[model samples]
Target: MDNASSQINISFNFISDISNIDYKKKKDFSNVYNIQGMLNIRIENELFFSEEIALLEFYIQVKKWLSNKFDGSFYYNTIEVEGDDNPLIKFVASDNNYFISSPWGQDKVIAKAKAESLIESIKIFTEDFEEELYRTYKLNPKWYI
Candidate 1:
């Protein structure tokens, strides 16, 4: 049997752009409408999965950003925010293959605020990583998108 956290490090590099629809928007018969509705539902599901993958990618990238900033060693599928009084930000893959929580906030702006807050509050810093990490703050979060 596979481990519970097996899905955490699993990347979805094969997902196609679900937004690239060939369908045209037009008035159609009721029956066609029903079929289109069903297809739309499927498309929505695909979009959801795509979003999930994107968010997960963002999380992983955040870890890399942290590592790059602090010159900290990187580990596979491991997340850590080191500080004696730092907020609890341990995110690991669960048995369900999803992260139990997000380190970043609901959106990019919130995520940036969270990062900034952590940087200011937490004393965890390495001489090598500090400069790089601070530079990341100047970058637009949209770059990750």
Candidate 2:
């Protein structure tokens, strides 16, 4: 693979009404948990996947993946977030490369790129996302990354 040609892009289009969240009540934080959004992933300038997902939950998963040093596979189910069972989207790492695929039947790699590139992309995305959360929603939730 040509490292120079590999790239990863992540962007979210939130569909939930965050203004109604009552920050005073801890239980109301569920509003954040239930926040829905469209997660768009692009690799090598091609769309890999675009799906509706739980925004906060998905952010937490990505943070966990970063904290784990990309040591193993990271999985997230889009349908599961909707309270239904579904196939999982997997990110697997090997020899410093990350392969993303939805392994419902076969090991079909959707996109593959270097770990450093993915990490850098995620870091940039996280920083901008955190800022947006703060500026737009006054949320500076505890981040694990």
TM-score of 2: 0.77
The lDDT values for all models are 0.26, 0.67
**Candidate 2: how many backbone clashes?**
0
List, residue by residue over 1-145, the lDDT tens digit for candidate 1. Answer: 5322211111222132324222243122211112111000011112111122222233334446565663432222322334441222222323222222323322211111122223322222222223432242232223232
lDDT for 54 in candidate 2 is 72
Assess candidate 1 and give its lDDT: 0.26
- TM-scores of the models, in the given order? 0.19, 0.77
Off by over 4 Å in 2: 1-5, 26-29, 77-87, 103-109, 143-145
Residue pair clashes in candidate 1: 69-129, 69-133, 70-129, 71-129
| Residue-wise C-alpha lDDT for candidate 2, range 40-145, written one tens digit per residue | 7778777776777777676767777777776687777554534433435676777777777754323345677777887888777777777776676666646322
